[model samples]
Target: MKQWNIGVYFSLRFQEIAGALDSALAVPILVPVQSSHSDENSQDLTLKQSVTLLESLRSCWSEDVLLISCADKFLRLSLQLLSRYSNWLSSGLADWKKGSVSSNPGCEWAISALPDDFIIHDINWLAKRICGDYLEGILQLLSTCSTEVLDLVKKSILHGGKSLSDLLPSVINTIIEALVDKSVEDLRQLKGITATYRMTNKPLPVRHSPYVAGILRPLKIAGCSRWRTSNNIFDRRC
Candidate 1:
């Protein structure tokens, strides 16, 4: 029989959510937080509030109930938006797996470092830079990069594969510039239709669904035959 550890799994989910939420809050508020005269005090207050909320949330739900409910919600969402949400889900799952696989103290350190405002600021900065010819370059990079290179970038950014402490300052600045450029109006208008058309033509692959990828591939492998490997689902196995 398959074994389950409800408490351990719930602790993991809470940690994952906490990290993501912290990241989401970090970005937009970073400049404001930094510029504040009482930056340290403000940061401490915000963190305390967040921790209190999370503690309250955990107290309200039993581990099994919370886990099952979240699973059901995700499954329902997946069924509704399989084509679009599949890639997102896979990426998130991959991040969680990466988080779990690293050394315990290292993992905790990574999670602790991923404060909410910081990630939000980074994404916001990225959005601003993704414009004009610069955006075209990024999309071109994204489109033309080898699968291995793309995988590496994904791991480096999303999976904590390297020392982001030293790397983040430069990468965040550059990515923000690239992303913001994309958000500009005239340039956006120029590319919007083409982008939509291209996206329609070459959709993002769902890493959690190999069958989906195989179906989308233009040609089949000759020797692979009718035999299909059932390795796409990115659930607990990952």
Candidate 2:
């Protein structure tokens, strides 16, 4: 009975820890992502801080405490926070591509902080940065966990509830939704090509569509330096 009460006490303390996570998260998350990846500040300090906090806590907490209290709550919070930021970035990029980025409220901050090196990037640069090291740290941290810890975390989850196992995939889906959409949108040029050919009564060439190259350009430029081999979708090639 005493041991059970002690476990409960730790669990409740963990609840407090989880509760405070949002406020700690707000400092980095609520800021504009463009500023986070600006010329003067190439490093996304916001993202770095968030990941560091999670890693710090994971290291600081005992495995037994984590198993008892189900630290996967932190994973969920991370997903929410990253999704919000990623979605904001995605929307902003879409706006920029459409030739209408809204005025940045952080202009003053940028001027004051950057003084001389304040440079806002185009949609292409921003997307490349994200696909580069900005999100690479996040993916590596989220995906590279011990199998034993993962199984324990999974078992600790409530029945029929999401476990830590889902965090990586959920994050990949949410964060990459922007790139995916852009790639799909590139396909619209094909309609223009078909229209042009139909007007001339020529059969489409057997050669690969240049639109295929267009679709792949951003991804190829993004260069999968830190975005490869993290996905665990094992399948038979045979």
Candidate 3:
């Protein structure tokens, strides 16, 4: 059994999992749900399914019959999966750049103070849920394994042994800042809000600001509390 895990079968399974991640995460995830909501998410679930497909092999260790390390397999496999997600995000950010970022100079700072723009809700959710929450969870899972397994898996990925502080935070920040840049770029109607007060000499209306509300509909659909953007990923709080 250990031989199977350490040899041809393991290699085949690893390729299959990498293929699964490509199939699942490659397309542009255009938008999140519009109305109803559920905690059961297919994106993260796809990641979990890929992990469990191999993690289940841990059964071999219990009988003292396993010489292979499941931890090594898990780390490599998880990195393979995240590589797919990171690629997809790279594409999105690139596409956004061609159409959005070059036009805006303050992209680096805009993400720090972006409005609750709806166009980027899906991007926001993925970065927050998958990269933020899910990656943290994956790290915790690795902590359960022996250091030998962790050390071995490091060779499987670039910067696999470096402190996350030295790597991931900047990458995540760039993607988010790009998304925020796109969101802020879409605020064409913003001038109209002030125009209503400037053009009209009539008394101030008591009703809620329609133009502002229209701009915030994405927040309404996604929920005000659910939306969050990071000014500084280097601060390690996304």
Answer with 1 or 2, whichever has the higher TM-score: 2
Best-to-worst TM-score order: 3, 2, 1
Per-model TM-score, in order, reads 0.17, 0.34, 0.41
Backbone clashes under 3 angstroms, per model: 31, 0, 0
Give the alpha carbon lDDT tens digit for every residue of 1-238 in model 2. 4356655665575456544443443342223223323333333322332333333343324344443233455445434433443343344334434444445321222212211101111222333443444334333443556777655544322211232222334434433554566688879887788788878978778898878888876566445522321121111111
Clash number for model 1? 31
The candidate that achieves the highest TM-score relative to the unseen native structure: 3
Query: Which consecutive 10 residues in model 3 have the weakest lDDT in total?
Result: 229-238
lDDT (tens digit, per residue) of candidate 3 on 1-238? 5345466655766666556555444332333232222323322222232233223322222233223355455455656554444444444444444454333222322223232233233333443444444544444556666777555543433332232223244455554564454456547667676787898996887886555555545445435433332211212221
Q: After superposition, how far is residue 234 of candidate 2 from its true place, in Å?
A: 26
Residue 22 error for model 2, in Å? 3.4
**Candidate 2 weakest lDDT stretch, 10 residues:** 229-238
* Backbone clashes in model 2, listed as residue pairs: none
Q: Give the residue spans of candidate 2 off by over 4 A.
A: 1-24, 27-50, 55-162, 175-177, 200-210, 225-238
Predictions in order: lDDT: 0.34, 0.40, 0.42
Model 1 Cα shift for residue 29 (angstroms): 7.5
